[model samples]
Target: MNYLELDTPALLIDREIMEKNCKDMQDYADREDVALRPHTKTHKMSKLALFQENMGAKGITVAKVGEGEVMASKGLKDIFIANEIVGEIKLRRVRELAKDIDISFGLDSILQAKMVEVAFEGAEKKARVLIEIEVGEERSGVVTEERFTELLDFLKQCSNIELLGVFSHDGHSYGAKDQEECRIINLEAQRRTLQFAELARKKGFLISRISIGSTPSMIFNFPILKGITEIRPGTYIFMDASQANAYGNFTRNAATILSTVISIPTEQRVIIDVGAKGLTTQRRTKGFTATKGLGRIKDWSGVALENVFDEHGILNHQKFHDAVQVGDKIEIIPNHICPVVNLHETAYLISDGKVIEKIPVDCRGKLK
Candidate 1:
């Protein structure tokens, strides 16, 4: 069936473009001599994650423990939860998953490490973990060398916890003013991450993997530092309006929302069936990835979603209003693909305008 026949407010994936995206990222990783561990949090689909693995991904990265569980159930052996896992319930889930898979999670403090150590006590395998270093994203990570040293010292006494390496995300690269700025942020973040890894090794810890990534940085094809081992970029799989703005084009965008024109109330006002619920209200208001509007209308140059409500999208363009009528189907590229993907239950894979396959968002809403 063609995508046009599908219902309104549907998620669509262009298979050909998506495959090229996967291959190009893998090739980039190979050229840099680093393993590609693309994050599954972007798509939240087991089939797509396995597709990435088949395309030479060393492993997969997830944000939440429940997402890791879903990927594991789908036969993903090597998984990394690239966020701190707190609480006994989530830590216990990670411990259970570690029994059969090479699973690891993020840690930034001694308090969190102690919880992990206790959760993995008496288990067959030690709880593997990566120390998160703050790289100017202002997010969760060890901000000072003293804090990192203290955490490492406490972990040395834990019998059930094993320090695998250190990782950092230059998420601030997304807000870089230009390519040069993005490059500078990427290099500094990687350097900082490597510094942490070297410090761990110097302290007699076996630091193996040094991972760093951000789609804005990785997309530029910058040189990887000497000690970095892996890159974990999630949004590269489905470039959105914001990323396209950063790249200065939408050629790399592979995912879009298929929506229908529901009303033509005025000469300059057109309404679409999809709104914040389907396409999301996300907008990049600063730097290179800054987007002009809520979403961009695919194939409609200079046309954007002016506003959106819960069930309707507003497009105020004289040309757009005159060109499209009610019942006309149009595709919209979201501002941020990650959260937009989690809003849908399934995605239709399109090839030459036909629906080739339908896959479920297996890890959607797996926030725990």
Candidate 2:
């Protein structure tokens, strides 16, 4: 079946592109001598996760507990809940998952360790917890070696939680001015992550993984230190507009929102079926190139998605609008693909306009 026959506002994945992106990123990680734990949150499709595993990813990473459960149910042996899984219900679920697979998660506070300890005290199995060190993301994790050491000490007391290792996300490395700056930030992030690992080792901890990297930091930038064992990059598999603008160039941007020109409301403007709900509202920040709104018209590369209503996207370029008409299908390259994918049920896997398979977003809204 031809994927183009599908209705508007449908999510589509170029299978060839997705496979290439997976292989390329895994190759990079292998060449750098680091374990590749591709984050599954980007696509939320277990099929894609398995593809990553098939392409040489050491393990897979999910952002939520539900996603972790879904992957584990599908026989994914090594899974990491990269976010803190707090609360009795979530911790118990993580512990349950650990019984079958190698389960691990991020830890930034003693409160989290205490929660995990209490959750699995009677179960005889303990979950490995990676103490996240803040390397500039400021989103989650311990900021100082003292805080991480204290967290490790607390974990030692808890018979139900094992100290996995140290991990950090150099998200700030995305803001680097050039490739040189990006590389500097990458090395520095590894440097900071290694420092925390050394402290843990000195404290008699069986520190295993010295993991660090975000797609923006890891793709173009290389780390100098061999102490870093694993590289965790999510966005490299599906480059978006913002990642493209930040990470040198977004050559592997496999994912895009395919929309249709529904109406020519005016002579200088045409409306598309994809709006904020379909394409998401993410945009790029400062860069040498320009990016705006939810998406850009693929036919007209220079034309940006000028205006977005609740269910309509308006492209207001005179040269671009003249060629478009009612009932015409057009491709829209989304600014960000993650959330854009989450809003859909099944993304059609396509190759040369042929529908290969309809992959379910199995982890959609699995927030619990």
TM-score of each prediction: 0.99, 0.95
Residue 62, candidate 2: Cα error in Å is 0.4
Q: Which digits, one per residue and each the tens of the lDDT, describe model 1 over residues 83-139? A: 999999999999889889999999999888888888888999999999999999999
Tens-place lDDT per residue, model 2, 1-368, is 88778888888778787788888788788787888998888899898898889889998999999999999888789998888788998988887888889989998999878887888888857778898888876788888777877887787788877887988888776567766777777778888889999999998999888888678776664654888888888877777777766654445677777788888877788888878888767776653223666676554656689878878888788988777678878877788777888888888888898988889999988878
For candidate 1, list the clashing residue pairs, or say none.
none
CA error at residue 283 for candidate 2, angstroms: 1.5
Model 2 vs. true fold: TM? 0.95
Compute the lDDT for candidate 1.
0.93
Best by lDDT: 1
Instruction: Supply candidate 1's per-residue lDDT for 38.
Output: 96
Give one clash count per candidate, in the order shown: 0, 0
